[model samples]
Target: MKLSLFLVSTAGLWVAANANSVNNKQTKNDVCTHPFVDINGRCLFVNNFAQMDWDAARAFCAGFQGDLVTLDEANLLADIVDFIYKEGLTDRSYWIGGSAGAQTGAFVWPDGSLVRMGTPCWGVLDNIQRPGAEPNEKCIALNKDNFFFFDNFNCEGEISVICEYKFQRENRWAEGGCATMKSSAVFVFLAAALLGSDGATEAGSHVKTDVCTHPFVDINGRCLFVNNFAQMDWDAARDFCAGFQGDLVTLDEANLLADIVEFISKEGLTERSYWIGGSDRALEGEWTWTDGSSVRMGTPTWGANGQNQQPTGGSEENCVGLDNANFFFFNDFPCVTAMSLICELKL
Candidate 1:
């Protein structure tokens, strides 16, 4: 009878220990508060509580075991904007994890990855309202008033902040690292919904795997190299790209212009113009890409309102470039004028 009682007691103890372990796992899974949301497996906390300078804002996020939100993916950025809009914080600016740091205009995230430039990442600031040259603006903020486009602000300036932590639910945090969500269907649907037609291709869609070599960014399956090494005239720039099995980049879509601009801005070339592949050399008043395709004109294509702003230099300015003076707009310039250039390679 004593042996029977001892076995029963041991079994009961084992059951109690297992129950406690399960409860602990459950608690960890549901860790975040009401204000935080699970976005693509990351717990994002949007702090609109008070405005603080960039350094202070970073400290606030760190206090919560997170860092200022680092938007490394384009789709993730779209989701963040959607989340902010849903929460009715569209009027306020929020500090994110990006700064030009010691290298002005070379924005990098906390993890040492370079921030992606241009559209969907940067809000389109009105050309007329844009500050005429503020080199002091090194830190980046989400200008919610302008649809969450990243805007450069002084580091010392006070702003709200967004904090993000790697999702540690499922007891994966202690095992090795943060656990990635396992649903492929969900990832596909999210990418489609956030990016729509203009954003980058779907996650697993057939895109060129091997386009250009190292140091070139892949945009919409095309490899683009922004040449900071050589500044040459339009023809000479074209030759430089040719040497690398590519040509000066040709802006096919209006959205593409933004991506190129972002790349240039991130490269710290905000004040320098770069040659793209567009010229009326074939027929006056009619632009054609180097590959012999007709240029798309008008809204979403040309910067600064319409075609009137572009090809403005008349017959003399045949080659096209992204103008530095008005960074968002394109301007016609003499083909012989020396400038930085962007090269593109298709897979």
Candidate 2:
């Protein structure tokens, strides 16, 4: 009878262990579902059920406790594009978190970070178009038709959306219904638990460090030097930057421009015009950066109105300078015209 009791007890223990294993597996699976796909440690949801305008699409993502996906890294964006292609979505455009806001051409993420422009971030001619002669395209979308290269579109235009939320290990639970919990609240709790009271990492925590040379301020992962020493013409300014193993600053992204503006304001240099690295000297009406990338013209890049507007001097003005007269909006000026300069170097 004792032997029989021992066998039954062992059987019960085994069954309990099996049930626990099954519960754990189910909890893992429940962390993500349907539209939400696990990608590079983040949970991303592609919503194609309804087409909505940019504002509406943003609201929809917010309702799910997520925001429109912001692609700061090129590799991350490529991964998302690949995921979309694998899912057989090759004909739809999905709204992302980039927009020019009140100032056109200065594209920024929803969180106010600069969206890297040109090359891999933007689609080729076939995939992206400016829509009209005017600078009215304020919103950005991922074009599946063009391999998911980002394209600027009208904000009012209806389109699908992609939402993103961070995935935390502690949030996974079989019986806690964590999937229905608000993402913001989960993030707060997780951050507190992981970071602890001191807000410093514990011993053996991995950290990343970056350093910049003297006189060059680190701005959004880039080293920038605003030359306050002297004012010179565009050609001389280019030579000045070349001396320091850099080039005249290229305001390719909106946030970069905003940072420069803020810096100027802080330094009391609001009235000084600065020479930037954009010119149409090679081909009239075709503005290109020092790196030979074509410039996305209009709106924030140009002055808001009146005589301060861009390319105002026509062929006579071949170089671009950030004019303080019109709140630092770029204006085409003669290459020989004297102005302060801004330089940039990659970290």
- Give a tens-digit lDDT track for model 1, residues 113-171: 56655433454455543221478888888765555657788989998888876443223
Question: Which consecutive 10 residues in model 1 have the weakest lDDT in total?
Answer: 14-23
Clash-forming residue pairs, model 1: 118-262, 122-149, 123-149
CA deviation > 4 Å runs, candidate 1: 1-35, 103-105, 128-132, 166-347
lDDT of 2 by residue, 185-267 (tens): 11101121112122222122211124335455545335567876688989899888877666887776544564566567667
Candidate 2, position 57, lDDT: 88
**Where's the lowest-lDDT run of ten residues in candidate 2?**
14-23
